[model samples]
Target: MNETIQTILNRRSIRAYESRQIDEHELQEILLAGEYAPTAMGQQPWHFTVLQNPDLIEKLQTLCKASFLNSDNASLREIATREDFQVFYNAPTLVIISGNSKAIAPLQDCVLSMANMLLAATSLGIGSCWVHSPMMVYGSADGAASLSNIGIDFPKGYEPYAAAVFGYSAQPLPKAGPRNSDTVTMIR
Candidate 1:
């Protein structure tokens, strides 16, 4: 199989990671991959925030857990209360993809960038996982406040649309799970 195809196929959502940080060069390359992702209408309105600060990561995790615990949803609260729960799986790096909330197509653009970053990480022997929970915190008023606490500022009228944690895996990669064939349809 082609290397690109193989990378896509082999990509997995890694949850556990070693404390070791990914090399700065590799992180830059991954961000470059995200920057090169195709955008709709050529609107490259996305913003990438690469966070490597352990203290900031821990603060964000604390905020996320507090937000989850205060949720109206019981399941989220329960999970947040779990002794072993971690918002970013203790990964050494957090890459947040955000864009103008008022844009006509911000989410799609941000997600594509996220996909590119994931594939790039996989190709570089790094592990990654798409994390949606942070969006909840980012969208909330309190959560938005915490952004400034970490010295991260979104472009005016922009907010985090997606995020992922990247680092060296602490365990072996799991085998790819079965795909849902029924979801596809032949139109031709």
Candidate 2:
């Protein structure tokens, strides 16, 4: 199998991270990989915000943690507002993927790009994760001021799409398992 396919098959979402930061070049390359993802109508109407500032990263973490911790849902509150909860899972960098809220299908495009970036990061020996849980706040201005502080327009019209955290992993990478037969469909 080719390396790209291998990367995809082998990729696993990392939730834990070490204390070190990824190099600026690697971060740029990962975002570049995301940019290459195909978009509907070629709108490319998405914005990529990379968080490299440690202080900012910490502040955002606190905000995310607070948001989750304050939720009324007992289960959700258990995850988000818990004393031990860390919004970014303590990862060193955050890549916020957002797009024109008005785009015909912004969520689909954003997810595709995020998937591309995740695969790219895996191939490069960088730790990464999809972070499906945080999209709840990223699209909300009251929720995502951290993105705005970095100069990314938190579009009241721009829907927050998805997010991925990148860094060096603190543990062994997991192996990909076989796909369940029930999950696949082939049409000719």
Candidate 3:
């Protein structure tokens, strides 16, 4: 079996992160992998905003908190409050995926791209968490304006699709859950 394939199967999401930052070269490669993910209609309309500055990352987290507090969506806001209203998990790096809304496909396309980056980071001995909550801000006045304040801009229809935090693990990660047979099928 190919090593890359093995890495893919072995990777898992890591929640707790060390304070150390990732190497620049590794970060670049991870983003490069995201850029290479297949996009619908070959329209690679997504932009990746990599966050390395600690101060800036904190600001983004603050904005995320404010957005969650102001979200009209009841279920999400209730759950966020239960989680202590924290966002971004204080990881050393954040990658925000945004896309052109001229078409709706960009939303899913950008998500797949971010997913690729997450696996890539995990394979590189790093930890990653896919954050879907902050994305809600992209669709609102407070969140949209907040994103712009953090140097993330939209080209009219462009909006955030997803955000992920990555870094070295602070503790050992749990083994991946069993690949339950029910989730797979073989086509004759």
Residue 141, candidate 2: C-alpha displacement in angstroms: 8.6
Which sections of candidate 2 miss by over 4 Å?
139-141, 144-156
Which 10 residues in a row give candidate 2 its minimum summed lDDT?
A: 132-141
Q: Where does model 3 exceed 4 Å of error?
A: 72-85, 178-181, 184-187
What ranges in model 1 sit over 4 Å off?
none
Would you give me the overall lDDT of model 3? 0.81
C-alpha TM-score for every candidate: 0.95, 0.86, 0.84
After TM-score superposition, the amount by which residue 115's alpha carbon in candidate 2 deviates from its true location, in angstroms, is: 0.7
Q: Which residue pairs does candidate 1 place in steric collision?
A: none
lDDT against the true structure, each candidate: 0.90, 0.77, 0.81
Give lDDT: candidate 1, residue 19: 99
Q: Which pairs clash inside model 3?
A: none
Which candidate has the highest lDDT of all? 1
Question: For candidate 2, lDDT tens digit of each residue in 60-106?
Answer: 66656665656666776777645677767778888888889788788
Model 2 scores a TM of 0.86
lDDT by residue (63-123, candidate 3, tens digit) is: 7666777878786677657755556666899888888878659888998899889888978
Candidate 1, 69-152: lDDT as tens digits: 878899999999889989899999999998987777899999999999999999999999998877888866678888678677
**lDDT of candidate 1 at residue 106, scale 0 to 100:** 91
Count residue pairs with overlapping backbones in model 2.
2
